[model samples]
Target: MLLLEKGIGGKSLLDIVKVVHLTKRIIPLFWGAFLSIFILFLPGRVWAIQNSYKVGIEDVLSITVWGEPELDKTVVVAQDGTINYPLLGNIAVAGYTVKEIDELITRLLAADYLVNPQVDVMVKEYRSQKVLVLGEVLHPGLYILTGPTSLLEIISRAGGVSDKVGNQVSILRSPVEERKIKDNEHASTSVEEKEAKSILIDLEELLKGRDLAKNIYLEPGDIVFLAGKKDTNISEQQVYISGRVQKPGAYEYQKGLTALNACIMAGGFDK
Candidate 1:
């Protein structure tokens, strides 16, 4: 009835009783408009995070040229971080993203060959960025990180950490980290270094926080290590049972195993 007074018309008193309405129907439309404006003009914009990789030495990339198969090629990044293309002969590709590489190739081709060439550069082999697991890992070795990979992921790939090892582990960021620590005094030190010493990526922290960001992005020749914890002295503990036991076996005496439990395991002196 109050809404009818505000122009929400009802047929009669009986109709008004039946049609209990609120303010103008435009209220929903107004709210919808407000929501739209809020979303569109939001101060902070959320962006889709992208995983990027820097091309490195010895990495192999496959270059595809649409409608120009002759220009298509597979080239290994040289020790000096360069590649030999058809016309671009010995172009440096390291430190450039795949998109940048494509643009570079397109520019090179348009300058001489095609009017507007389509260049596609893909990492056929990601030998450039490999995760190296060493020290106390069950299967410590070099693991190729083809795509998105993390500390726990790499550890799982390496057959999980050795039971003897503790949660303490470290990840060394690749060539950059190496160069950063070197005596290249002329090199400009970036913010990464200021945080590198004490804030080097810790595996324990990653395991706790479940945050992949805590785990450093692995690169070629990056070394990861699992530190060993205190050893359990199994040599000193021993258990022996003597009697008419079925399938009798010697069980190692552990922290809390009792004589009765050991006997029960050995068929309990069968009558």
Candidate 2:
């Protein structure tokens, strides 16, 4: 009985090993199939997200009406957040999404000109809402916003922070009321004199994910400026170790470096 039990136990172990090996071989194929499906559906998901993006000023749009080729037109949103469509005159579409625009145009066309008109709206170019990122960041420049973008997202789009980035970040945003007044052409000189509101954030806390509230959603026409650790230029960073030191010359200056360390790097004392 002992011999039979031992033989059965050995067979069970062999079967377990074979099953584990088979599972290992099958797992890769299963993941490959899953990844293929994900890849196939990624473009559709991206299109859905982009389609929901609100139209803004200076954004180029392509409007097409089915069965009416003459009605197909490419138009650009004006500064006042309006577009001129043929027979429709000036239509406000700054804050409306592409789907909303399509529905609106379809409804208007059916009400007056055509019966059951089908309309399609597509964003040809994104130029309306933009933010400027500068100072202590890699590739600092202006970036266009597709949707609701956060401060961190714009910073990431500018290629993240540089090595010399400091602990503080400043965001300059125009007042909402001021912008509204300006848009209406009723802004006074006093409103123009009012500077943009400055928001200071602790970069250390933000980067560590400790103060998530500091990662506020950025607005269009906002300016982001990142502070630096030192104001000195890289070319001007040098330590002159001349007195009583061997190989005394200009040594590269680094943060928290002391005179003793500089002397040591210069080959110690002259003796």
Candidate 3:
């Protein structure tokens, strides 16, 4: 009986080892199949983790290639999205990520007898980050937005809202139609009219401690505006009080307005 029990235990141990080995092999195969399927379903142009630079018209960029000093040059991006390089000569670098520019420079250098070139690109000065502030701001003009600048930051830099107006502001961004218009030159909308789509931002809510999801990163050519909010109170219900009062002008007749105070602003009812 003891020999029979030992034989059963040994058989069980062998079965356990076989099951563990089978699981180890099957798990790796399952994981590989899942990873392959996921990769196959991913977007073709997977954007790398990158820091994008906003290229403005007339912004200067310094490019340096190690071991190839002849290709080093400081170039300004033109308004038409083109840059002049030493050897490449008028390569379009605007709207391209820095990594893309680096790869392009590497290819250019390799063509001209340099192997495995090391390229460095830097923005020496940013002159192209300007946005326009219109409407009820005390000063309305083109304001420069530096790195990571948002709509509220640009508006605050523009000297706040006018005292006479409420805090409803409109941030006008050219609509998607603008892109279509650029693509199709013969589109019906005029250039001036096509540039009219803008997103509205409420500064009053922002001031009132509202969530700031409405405030987004402001781009070049964006128009920030402060427009007046319509007063819902009935004008007819307000009492017109002029003269030497503690607070002059129209007051809500329901509370706080007396005939005696109204006379004060109007020179205190002639004795």
**Candidate with best TM-score:** 2
Candidate achieving the largest lDDT: 2
> TM-scores, in order shown?
0.54, 0.60, 0.54
Clashing pairs in 3: 172-198, 173-198, 243-264, 243-265, 243-266, 244-264, 244-265, 244-266, 245-265
lDDT to native, each model: 0.51, 0.60, 0.48
lDDT of 1 by residue, 193-269 (tens): 21111124454555555665765545444446555444634344344433334544455544333323444566743
Q: Mind giving the per-residue lDDT tens digits that candidate 2 earns over 1-271?
A: 0000001111110000010000111122333343344335545555674677777768899998989999999999876667888877877776678987797788778878899998989988887666656555565556777766777767767666666666778776633222212121111112232334678899888766699799888866565777666652444345444534576566665543432344468785443
* lDDT by residue (tens digit), candidate 3, 1-271: 0000001111110000010000111122333343344335545323421336545456678889987778788888775556877756666665555666677677777877687889987776666555556544445566654455666556556555544345566664532111111221112122232433546556656644484687678765554655533442223343343322234344443222222222343343221
Q: What would you estimate as the lDDT of candidate 2? A: 0.60
Model 1 Cα shift for residue 179 (angstroms): 9.1
* Backbone clash tally (model 1): 0
Ranking by lDDT: 2, 1, 3
Quote the lDDT for 131 in model 3. Answer: 59
Query: Which portions of model 1 miss their true places by more than 4 Å?
Result: 1-51, 173-205, 208-213, 232-271
